[model samples]
Target: MNTSASHDPNCIFCKIIAGQIPSKKVCEDEQVYAFHDINPWAPVHFMLVPKAHISSMAQLGQEHAALMGHIMTLAPRLALEQGCNPYPDGGFRVVVNTGAEGGQEVQHLHVHVMGGPRPWAKG
Candidate 1:
């Protein structure tokens, strides 16, 4: 994590990162934190959040390149570690919801890493 990681006092993800809120943490490093989603959409559903508080994807800028890159690179590794299979056999989906219209409930930026056999709607 950056020595001067930015945080928002009201951000739930920030509290999780600060250890104020407990989470089923799956991965943690210098720049990001990964944990199981409270309400999973798949057999393997986890969230990857940046320690620094970026309101939403709409706010991302070139300055956030490294952090974004780190999150992307870390996702597959954690997904596999959390039970998603490898390439041809199985894979995972990474989703970033920017705003309300995008299905982002939380104001903080987070990437949802989901995999395994997903449930499909009845046709």
Candidate 2:
């Protein structure tokens, strides 16, 4: 985890990362926080978020490369741990919605890892 990482007081993910908000956490390290989605889109649906307060992908730069990589690397492992099948045939999807136009409801940069048997959709 980067010591310079900052949190936004009003960001839900920030609050969740800080223990200010409660979440059904899947995992957490200094760099990221993984948790079950309040409204799951699949049998396995969770989010991996950076501890930093990045507003969106639009704000990402070279400085975020390592953090982004860390999140990506953790997503599938956590997805499988949450019950997604193994790789090669059984898999998951990693979704990161950027702005409002991209259907991002939250301002934080978080990746959604969703999997399991399909015909899955969020109500």
Candidate 3:
């Protein structure tokens, strides 16, 4: 939808946002795209990705505050909708891998929302 300079043509997440790649979508809006992870580490594992192609968390600025907030706030709701339980005992993990050392495989900025029964093999 947003074919602007903010989008990276080569980025996988961008491709998914642009419908260039197939994804098990959870939800989508003008600012964000949420989808099930191909290799989930938990029973309910999905990602919240901004449509704009920011490379990583290190690149975030004041301009992205609202977007980040929206993502964070949306996580729990989406997590619950995706089968994560309520709260207290039922919770989720929000992960943002910053760079290579941080274990980020994709260059595009995204938030990983993992929840549901644990004892997951990996994350």
Q: Write the per-residue lDDT of candidate 2 for residues 6-116, one digit (tens) a residue.
A: 988888999999999999999999989999999988899999988888888888888889999888888877888899999878899889998899999999888999999
Pairs in steric clash, model 2: none
Per-residue lDDT tens digits of candidate 1, residues 3-121?
22388898899999999999999989888899999988888999999988888888887788998999999998998999988987789889998778888998889999988865621
Give the Cα error of residue 59 in candidate 3, in Å.
0.1
Candidate 3 pairs with clashing backbones: none
TM values, all candidates: 0.91, 0.92, 0.94
TM value for model 3: 0.94
Regions of candidate 2 where Cα sits further than 4 Å from its true position = 1-5, 121-123
Q: What overall lDDT goes with each candidate model?
A: 0.86, 0.87, 0.90
Deviating ranges (above 4 Å) for candidate 3: 1-5, 121-123
Residues 2-65, model 3: lDDT tens digits:
2234788889998999899999999998899999999899999999999988888888888889
Model 1, CA-based lDDT: 0.86
Task: List ranges where model 1 is wrong by over 4 Å.
Answer: 1-5, 120-123
